[model samples]
Target: ENGEFKPAYNDTIKDYNTILEMFDRILNPDPMSYTSPELKSVFSKFKDLFEKHYEEQKELENSYQVQSNTSTQAIKAKLS
Candidate 1:
């Protein structure tokens, strides 16, 4: 329950987008001079993990879209 950043693998797309936006703010704070080296290092790790999750989810969505479109086209062809 710690407010630590972790990948929300099963979360909906909207939730994932919200987490990404928050993480972006955390990784790039307005006053960059105030962040400690250790904190920065930790945030960097979070960024890497989050980026991987984002990419994986993006690929899945793209494949699903392709499949949906193909199915729709096949249905249309059969109907016509």
Candidate 2:
């Protein structure tokens, strides 16, 4: 729980849940029947951006994990 924000580890799940909610809203036509075309377009854009952000964050997390594991193994080797 450092001050640094880790999107991959911390925000990914929350963001994904939010995305799921967005998807549900988009797919359920009953509630959105009255929504304007402009608003729907905006929602579509938002969903795309969220997906891109999620992918970037996940990649960053994977890179960090790989680096961390490599460092740990090096430390262990040095100690041995």
Candidate 3:
């Protein structure tokens, strides 16, 4: 299975977690489960990509939240 990712059987976005949780699962899958070097390598590579994406998404969300909260606070102050 060179360059092929194993599909998560019957899984959907509804099962997904926030960015940090995703990163945690990637870097910490059950070590006893993988018996081949190739598979392990692939897992590592995939995890790296996932972790990067997670970090980027988390940053974006945080930034958006900060802006939204600031705007809300400003609006509240003006209203009062």
Candidate that would win on TM-score: 2
**Each prediction's RMSD to truth:** 7.2, 10.9, 7.0
- lDDT (C-alpha, whole model) for all candidates: 0.78, 0.75, 0.70
Q: Is candidate 1 or candidate 2 better by TM-score?
A: 2
Instruction: Report the alpha-carbon TM-score of model 2 versus the true structure.
Output: 0.69
Candidate 2 wrongly placed segments (more than 4 Å): 1-15
lDDT of 1: 0.78
Ranking by lDDT: 1, 2, 3
List clashing residue pairs in candidate 3. Answer: none
**Segments of candidate 1 deviating more than 4 angstroms:** 1-32
Off by over 4 Å in 3: 1-34
> Which has the greatest lDDT?
1
Q: Can you write out model 1's per-residue Cα lDDT over 1-80, one digit (the tens) per residue? A: 59887754555665666777766666666674366678878988987898898899999999999999999999999999
Ranking by TM-score: 2, 1, 3
After superposition of all CA atoms, the RMSD between model 2 and the true structure is: 10.9
Error of 2 at 42 (Å): 0.7
State the displacement of the C-alpha of residue 37, model 2, in Å, after optimal TM-score superposition: 0.4
lDDT (10s digit) by residue, model 2, range 1-80: 77977543345455577766756566454653666678778787777887899899999999999999999999999999
